[model samples]
Target: MGDSASRSRVSYPVFQDVNHMVIFGFGFFLTFLKRYGFSSTGFNLLIIVLGVQCSVLIEDLLIFLLQREDENSLKRITNAVVSMTAVVISTGALLGKTNPVQLILMTVVEIIVFHMSRWINETFLQVPDNLSMTHVHLFGAYFGLAVSSRFSEPLPRSEKNASTPKSDLLSMLGTLFLWVFWPSFNSVLAVDKSKAIYNTYFALAVSAVTAFLLSVLTTKDGKFRMTHIQSAVLAGGVTVGYAGHGIKYPWIAMILGLLASVISILGSYCLQRCLNPALKIHDSSGVHFTFGLPGVLGALAQVVLTVINNWTNSARQGHLVTVHIGAFCLTVSVALITGFITGLILNLKLFKTIPVSKYFEDQLYWEFPHLAVGF
Candidate 1:
């Protein structure tokens, strides 16, 4: 009994670490572009704080509305952080494209959508998942991407290509913060404490190694790019979370990491080459590669390979395989529809508008050192 209690004690530190990842990881990682430092940190701060607060309320109300007995303040806050991470992921898709108020509105809509989807999954579907890929990664990425596509047309690059030595270094700091704490982020939800934690760490190491090697392998000059380092290295966790848990052998996780890393690296490259020029789809942090593709594909791949009866035996699963598929489809549809509507609302004339020329520059949104309003 004491051992069980001790294992549960890990929750507090897990909360602290995930908080660091958000406060530091998400903010500074997006600071790679030299010009957008203020928007990256300042607006990110605004949007994420709003996400956390709204998550607190939505999650609490959800508990009461559903009449859950085991739910408590600590669990609600933990879930709020998890949901807030999803919000942060969505914001990555719209980074530098929209203003602060737009994001606040989007966050409110997203949290409500997220909880609704979650409630359906919990109440009707009850499928157990070992990773955040579904809850946090896939929904946020796709939701943000859908919203971004709506706001996008044939617009010239809303952002600039300004990466300095210092910006790169700071980006690495954010990467380091994310990489170190990700195990805790994933492990916080683990039911089998020891094995799940081991799987998380193993997957992180393999994915980092794979992402680094693949990143180097694909680059023309054999020089490491911060984009790959800052993002794809974390695919190890995503890959593991996707479906590698409880496999009879351990090396399979390494292979999954390798595949996920390769896809992530190429996905980023393709978005830069094909999407930006053709459609002005500017994913500021290339989150599609790190979070979107990996999460969706991982979930699909796991579903394909996993035995339905097997999953039924896992905790909380009470439905047929078709129900799980329906839940995924429902979540995706709701996210896209909500995101599109949110984009339309942002485009309405009620909000403060940012000039095209000053899209990525911090001066438009913030008062800082020698802030210059674009003519």
Candidate 2:
């Protein structure tokens, strides 16, 4: 009995407190960075990020709050309030802006950010642990890459199907609220009106076309399907982001985005099928390290794309070829090092901690009885 009790104690919830602390610390650091670099543009971007974060939190909070009541009615109320607030704020801010074009551009960017955030939260946080990490990561990567493709996939029934039409309407309104704020998130930084317009429309067009194609090819049953269009959009966007200012080859952006989307989907599938089973770990959280690997790859891709574009442009202009090699190297090195250190700190539990509530256990049983068996 004593030995059995000790073993049970050892297995009891050791990670929750640590996980909470790491998340809060990360949020604090992000907040600090934003404030330190505060400017009109920076402030707006920070708000946009915060808005995305808040949107998720609000949804979760509303659902939790309504769980004991009429789930349908409470959900409807939550959606309505969230949607109204978003619409009011966005409309007010854009009104009387110096450049209507800039406002419109910012709105589009905000929509992308909003969608990415939702996709990450849903694919990573909401799913059962039995689902492999590769599955979650692939979902997230493809979703992000799909942004450049400009496609509108249907919301998951889990996300969209509420108890009532009113609830569904509210949920959609909240989504639209996100759509309205998206463009402003990044486009506010663009100095040239023409460039801003081009970037905004271009991103939207790519995303829309990719989404449309996916919808056409996908079966009516709504099973998620991977395609090359998603990769093309992401790669294209990354390429354009690196050198769009100087390069006239906007098509390069689309091509690269398409390629990235394909690679991301295929890589994720391969990782899940080939690598995950061998490791014996299921669930995305268990494979957190794998998810982060793409960020490193993305940084490298950005560097290579930027250098090539710069070199090509410089050759055409016959400019003195003094590269800011030190600055570029330092930036990438610092970013990589910082990311590594941060991951280590979180894993090591060098910061504060939080305790998962016992109440959550009941929730696990109620919402996912089968999953509750494993816990």
Candidate 3:
């Protein structure tokens, strides 16, 4: 028992860090609405708790049935919580628009699909580590977008969807938590923790600097937009998700960080406006810019590095390249399709969807003091 406890204690730091990211980090990250603060954090808490329970059961059951083996309880729980991170990302897209019931249903369904996709990627494609980026980040972002595309209600002229100074400040706290702990997130399943941490730390540092610079340049009055800082600043962390473990040089990580920040800032500031009309996706939290694109960039970086290594070593690892490409394509297709179908189910009249007038408001879900309500 003492030996078992000692082994468990060794993994505690990473588990604690990931737990913080999933709860406090993501919970506060969603609290950016002027009036929807209660729902944002409250519903997020709901989804996460349920995800932790449901994901573990699903993952364990799948492993038992398919592989006829059981995984360590701690490892399964940790991965389950990490899987919830993707569900939280998806929740970000449909934030103010979804009712609690819809959110709960989405959480349950997404977890099943998430694990299924993960199994396929790891087992069939033989791309185990890469699933962290493709299955979680890429899958989460596109899944949310697919669901968003299915529900096309326009924000009413009177809707209180814009963030206030206080709300944005709270949201920044979430961003800081994610930023400080993201190296742990990127390096959680890595073979070499030191290399992963080194690359991720540099990448995130440069990404933060680049986000600030781009935020200033993009805005007319040279002011940093809270939105960019909250979202784009984390792109570097996402950029190193898959490649961090393999990245040897700090410079390469820095360059990837620079590129990721540019793409995130541009996508958030420019492409985001075009999403509704062009793709019919109403991503409430810009997850595509922050998680989806940066994740793909990270996965591509891994592929490129693999090709270069093959060339230099005179080795033919075409199978590896095929795995990366196949994993990417398969992840996109599964996430979007499953998400769209889930949206369609949630939209059924039985679900009792939120009315348009109540969008982004806390009154529908939370109780406030009479004095606060009057104000």
Report the lDDT of model 2 for residue 99: 27
> How do all models score by TM-score?
0.87, 0.36, 0.95
Instruction: Please provide, for model 2 over 258-374, each residue's C-alpha lDDT reduced to its tens digit, 9 standing for 90 to 100.
Output: 444444444555655776456432221111212223323433444555567567576632321122223223333432343233323322333321122221112311244565666
Superposition error at 206 for model 3 (Å): 0.3
* lDDT winner between candidates 1 and 3: 3
Give the whole-model CA lDDT for all candidates, comma-separated.
Answer: 0.71, 0.32, 0.86
Give the clash total for candidate 3.
0
**Candidates' RMSD to native:** 3.8, 22.1, 1.9
Question: Cα deviation of 368 in candidate 1 (Å)?
Answer: 2.1
Model 2 vs truth, CA RMSD: 22.1
lDDT by residue (96-192, candidate 3, tens digit) is 9888989999999998898888788877887774354435888899899899887866564554878888999999999999999999988877888
